[model samples]
Target: MRPGERAVLLGPGEIGEPTVDDWAAWSDTLPHEVVTGLGARLHRHLRPAATTTLRSL
Candidate 1:
């Protein structure tokens, strides 16, 4: 994705406890060039608004 492109994550309560092995596993399953952590606090703060804005954009 481009520099300004927006992304959101969905999972089964694993966002806060992500590890190196989690990333490595994601790398194999995701189609993107990279897969990185989105800390729980930031994810929680932005999830609602970000989803709306991203859809409109």
Candidate 2:
């Protein structure tokens, strides 16, 4: 999604906003080292997806 755009995940039921503890729990479910490595790879892969917008004065 673009900046300021809203996104919703459609599943069997509505997913509510996550709390700090919820995030902590979710993080605990994943392998931290693997997740961190994947994050770095994803960042490298998606970095070029960012673009700059120009406005005329």
Candidate 3:
């Protein structure tokens, strides 16, 4: 990992109740690193595109 390296953080299945509170309640279910590893980067929590993720920031 380095500066300008884009990483799309996504969940393979339903990570939570589509809300932060629900997820936090059972935070153990999620990988511990998911919370601590994020820095000042762009993050989009959504379903990944079948081909490529194209959208407007």
Candidate number achieving the greatest TM-score relative to the actual structure: 2
Q: Worst ten-residue run, lDDT, model 1?
A: 48-57
Better of 2 and 3 by TM-score: 2
**Candidate-wise lDDT, in order:** 0.44, 0.40, 0.48
- Scored against the true structure, residue 36 in model 1 reaches a CA lDDT of 38
- Give residue 47's error in model 3 in angstroms: 6.5
Q: Write the per-residue lDDT of candidate 3 for residues 1-57, one digit (tens) a residue.
A: 999885534443353323333344456544444455446584655664456646563
Candidates ranked by lDDT: 3, 1, 2
lDDT of 2: 0.40
Please write out the lDDT profile of model 2 over residues 16-48, one tens digit for every residue.
744333444666753344335444433232223
lDDT (Cα, tens digit) per residue for candidate 1, span 11-55: 323456554445657677542323334444553422333233232
- Best candidate according to lDDT: 3
Q: What residue runs in model 2 are displaced by over 4 Å at the alpha carbon? A: 6-15, 29-57
User: Over the full model, what C-alpha lDDT does candidate 3 score relative to the true structure?
Assistant: 0.48
Ranking by TM-score: 2, 3, 1
* Candidate 3 off by > 4 Å: 11-26, 29-42, 45-48, 51-57
User: What would the C-alpha RMSD of candidate 3 be, to one decimal place?
Assistant: 10.3
Sequence-dependent TM-score of model 3: 0.25
